[model samples]
Structures are given as structure tokens and as C-alpha cells.
Target: MMHPRLLATSIAVVIWGCGSAEAQTLVLGGRAGLTSATQWLNQPYFGYQRVHGTTAGVAATLELGPYFAVQAEGLYVEKGARYYTSYQMRMSYLEGPLLARLSWPIASSRYRLFALGGMAPSVELRCAGYQTVNNPVVNFFDAPPGTSPLDCDSQRQRHTDRSQVMGGGLAFDRGPSQVTLEFRRTRGSDIAGYDC
Candidate 1:
């Protein structure tokens, strides 16, 4: 697999090239967002838990034309499973998306739309994947009489694979500023993690 720093660099360079000529025309901004996933993705978990959580991050977008742009974001998420012995995991990631956007004004009502697909390489910093075991580093939500602790070995590793990113949103523009509501999903591996 590629190094995390290298992956991020490649994304930046490629995006820069895609809109280099119109770099000045790009709209520079930041994003505040969150993420959630199903429990199936958290297999081999320490225990039976909800496995749903929120991830927050920021992104910057580069627009080459009215219909073409590139965006990059970095995020951190905390998640856990609620079983006999609950376990928690923390993930950090950086993502890049090649976006196709459209914008036009209808009288005084302005609108903007964009769709994106890209790669996201992530790093697993802290994870308590073995809470079911007798000696767990983290606490639990609910456990059976003797579950011998949940399988938490997977949480003690790091993966940086190219993850999949896809999503879009609508925005209202007024002059140089706009307000947008967007949603996206970063599909990671079921066992390989969000990166690998």
C-alpha cells in the first residue's frame, strides 16, 4: 500500500494540475461534516454494540470551471459496538474527490450543485477491538456472564488504503458567499478497515 503522506501528496498534485490554469477561479473553502455506517462493517468486534458514530472533518475545494472541480477533506471519527462487552475505535482519514459541479442564476435565486468521487486513505490511531477478552484496555456497554471478552485484536493496527468517496449537495448563492447542505459516504472495507 502507499504511504499516507504520499497518498495525500499525490491527491494534492493531481488536483492542482486539473485546475492549474484556472486556479485563480477556484472557490477556496472549508467543510464541517460527519459520518456513520452499519454494524456489519464492524465485524469481529469486541462485543455486540450499535457500531454507529459520528465523524467530523474539513475540506477545501478547487473549481477549474463552472462544471469541474476537485475537493479534499480530513476527518476523525469515534465508533463502538454495543454487545456483551462494548469496544470503541477511533479513525482518522484524508480524502480527495474529483467533482463535477454546475451553477447558474435564475433571476435573483441562485443555485449550485456538485457530485464527487475520489480516494480516501485513512490511519487507525486508537481502537479497542478486544474488549470481550478478560483484560481489556477500554470499558464496555453490556456483557454476558462470561464472554471471555470480545475480539479486540483488530483495533491495534493501522491501515491506509485508497477508500471510496461519493456524494453531493445543493447550495444557495448570494454574491460571493453561499450556504450548502451536503451528504457523502466513504465506503471502507468490512475487515480491511476504512483505508485498506
Candidate 2:
């Protein structure tokens, strides 16, 4: 659950932006994209690899001027990493990003270039892992006496994560509609047991 103060602050920002008369334009749109996510682990024994996922969301932008805007989004994002040879972990979250955007038009206002920097707060919806081991083990300390190494799956409950996001993109304007191509990087918070 989100803290009440955080929720109130978010609401205040939105209300202030919309209430300002200097906000000359409002753009509302939806976006979908692919994400390559991986964990940054400090453990020497664990080598994490990127895992591909999907992200989709709706965005709202309040233009403060010709070159400045405040944008916010509500998105569903999938993030995780792979370790060892056949072990994988996955986490899904509902994320919200608040960004400051700067844009300028070029080539007779048909093309626009923009850059954005933001912070995203995400709440975990699900977490799971997949592990596969071929060698059978019977060590009581780590497993039951007769326990055998086999494919296994498990789920975990985790807390919310806050990430730093920054990116740049290009947009093409056609009358009232615009198309954008953006590239962004999201650096997630470190887990308690994970070093760095």
C-alpha cells in the first residue's frame, strides 16, 4: 500500500499542474514497448542475465510552455533476471512515473526532439522463480534427507520498489496525433539481501 503522504503529494502535483493557466496544452496517449530488465547483484556467485518483457501504459502531459512539460504515466511493467544456467526470477509491478520533459520542434514543426528525466514508484503485483537442477542431493542441512534435485518453482512476496528513470526520444507530429519512439533506462532499488 502507498503511504498517505505520498498519495497526497501526487494528487497535489496533478491538481497544481492542471489548475495553472499557463498550461496551454494537454496530451493524452497510450504506449506499449519491450523491456530488457536484469538485476544488478553484488554476489560473486550469481551472474544475472537480461530477461525480455513487455510494458504498456497510458500517459498524460501538461504543457507548461512551448519547451517544457510535466508528464505522468500509469504502467504495468515486468522486470527480472536469469541466474546460473536454468534459473530465472520474475517480478511484475504497477508503476507510476512523474517526469519533466523538454521538447523543441524542428523542420517546420513536423519533427520534435524531447528528453525526459523522472522517478518511478512501483508496487509489486507478483514474484516467482524457476529453478532446474540435474544432480540429486540428500543433504539434510540444505534439504530433506531424501531430497532430490529437480525442477522447482516458487513464489515470494516483496515490497514496493522505487526506480530512477531517464530517457530521450523523438516524436513526429501529424495534425492532432503524434507518434513517438523512446528509449529509457530504469534502475531499480536494491533488495535487502542483495548487496549493491
lDDT for each residue of candidate 1 in 99-170, tens digit (9 for 90 to 100): 444443344556766555666666555544433355534334444443334444544233443457777777
Instruction: Report lDDT (CA) for all predictions.
Output: 0.53, 0.75
* Model 2, C-alpha of 96: deviation from truth (Å): 0.4
Find the 10 residues in a row with the least total lDDT in model 1: 38-47
Which of the numbered candidates is closest to the native, going by highest lDDT? 2
Please tell me which predicted candidate would have the highest TM-score against the true structure. Answer: 2
- TM-scores of the models, in the order given: 0.59, 0.75
Candidate 2 TM-score over all chains jointly: 0.75
Per-prediction backbone clash count? 15, 0
Predicted structure 1: lDDT: 0.53
Cα RMSD to the true fold for all candidates? 7.2, 7.1
Candidate 2 displacement at residue 2 in angstroms: 19
Give the lDDT of residue 16 in candidate 1. Answer: 47
